[model samples]
Target: MKEITMPQTVRGVVAMAKGAPVTLENIVIPDPGPGEAVVAVQACGVCHTDLHYREGGINDEYPFLLGHEAAGVVESVGEGVTDVAPGDYVILNWRAVCGSCRACERGRPWYCFATHNATQKMTLEDGTELSPALGIGAFADKTLVAAGQCTKVDPAASPAAAGLLGCGVMAGLGAAINTGNVGRGDSVAVIGCGGVGAAAVAGARLAGAAKIIAIDLDPRKLEWATDLGATHTIDASTTDVVEAVQALTGGFGADVVIDAVGRPETWKQAFYARDLAGTVVLVGVPTPDMTLELPLIDVFGRGGSLKSSWYGDCLPSRDFPMLIDLYLQGRLDLDAFVTETIGIDGVEAAFARMHDGDVLRSVVTL
Candidate 1:
């Protein structure tokens, strides 16, 4: 355990009400409790999940401290903590799996049911409790989290690029490499070309897939996808996605079709755009209001795995540092994902630009 010298309060972005603008407020961060650590955030990426929290799309939890994709230095650790210490550079992960959970017992910690967060709540100046989004809440100068959430990485890596591995980018990459099991000479098709989708395309390329097809309605997003490593691009606004994918794959469809959009229509497209016995990886998060209506016969006929990727089925401790190394080695272009870096004050504006389809990520560098 390390000695704690945490501040009584720090400036943080907070969502006070549903569908309302988030504001910077003084948040009281308590000293780390047992199994917890305090992190001095260096960089945090603005993700769709944060915007979802603001719009009440995730839940009714108000006064939310929103920001998850992050990289930082360890400021302190609490009692019984030894895996990390002060001054260690790390990437923050949302899933800090509990070792005693069923999934962990079975050696699948990525699916662990008991992910943890700091026992102490971060509060506003008025003592109002703020729910840290995804239990990370890194849109601040510092944040408290479970010690396991912090995955140590090389200090030489750019914080802006490394932080992205904490969420969207990791999910996208894992959707293809981990869930899709993309391999050399395989034909992979990714639906949606947002941050997650673009990373999936990159992941497919990294995994040595022979042909990568990127599908998106936005031409700019498609271009970004190509930059990431899509061998082919489909303009969904004017073309039939399934047909285009099939056409590119010689009428057999792709070996792995990833649905990064999570919409019912996109999921259906992914479902039908894979070859017989091909994998369908659903990495995009779908809202509760959305429903799927697939024929039972098709489910049997597909004869392949239909898997939903939770955080891209990534094990943070294993993936973060490895991906950072790949980025440093020039094999993975993590810098391409960082569209811009802004101060904490620019978060609200970043949220607006996110919808414009021009930016891949707006990182907040503290």
Candidate 2:
């Protein structure tokens, strides 16, 4: 049995107010309660979602404890928790699906309506309650999360790389393989060559896409897409994106078009940049004020599916370990995503670099 102990103090990044910069402050993590576990986080990726949380894009949850994409080792487990035990290497995920939820009951836990988080809350040293980002705040030495949130993976896998499977990478891969249902020899086009976009390209490759077209405004990101298995690239800034995609696919466009940009204009391009009956997957995060005014006639004329991917429509327990195995087997280049690694203190600057389109990921190593 795992021995329970007193609350522990650790420093974590916090966003105190909307649009304000983040700061490192001492946080008090209580022992895991029923069905919860404590993790000694090894590495956590800095995702744009964290930036959004800091900017008040997700919600008005103030003094938010940021950081989610993470890999760690189980340090303790609470009463009745049995999925993971001490010393287990694990990836932390937000979707700790409740087994009896509607989606779970329907055998589609991926769309779980009721996900679990730590039953107990971690707070500032001053005792102010903190809302953890995505329920697995991990930009610290330790974090408390629901036991189901931790998916055991290959201990040999690099925590920095395996941790990526927790969020953006999984979302992108799941967007292509799970949501988009990309099949062998399919022609695919992905817009926006950011972390999610690049991962989408990799997913397309892993799904055996014969001709992958990557579209982005930045030359650097386009180059990244090419390296990630895109067979062709389109400079959306200087080209008619839809026309270019059509030309690449014998004037019929790709079979699957992914909009990782999440903007109205890019989404419109994806809508028209696919063949009739083709699919369009939107994996990008869009602002609330953003709106799309599309012709109703086109919806009837297009004759295809338009879907938005949340967390890539993924099931962490099913996907994380398998992806990590692929990574360890040299089939998936998870390392390609880690552009740089930094200390916890380097997060703010890393955010700037991410905003500037400088890197795919900056991992925070403890």
lDDT for each candidate structure: 0.94, 0.94
Q: What's the lDDT for residue 351 in model 2?
A: 93
The residue ranges of model 1 lying beyond 4 angstroms of the native Cα positions read: 5-7
Please give, for residues 129-225, the per-residue lDDT of candidate 1 as tens digits: 9999999999999999999999999999999999999999999999999989999999999999999999999999999999999999999999999
- Tens-digit lDDT string for candidate 2 (1-366): 456689999989999999888999999999988899999999999999999999988999789999999999999999999889999999999999999988999999999999999989999999999999999999999999999999999999998998998999999999999999999999999999899999999999999999999999999999999999999999998999999999999999899999999999999999999999999999998888899998999989989899999999999988998898899899999999999999999889999999999999999998
Candidate 1 worst ten-residue window by lDDT: 1-10
Backbone steric clashes in candidate 1, count:
0
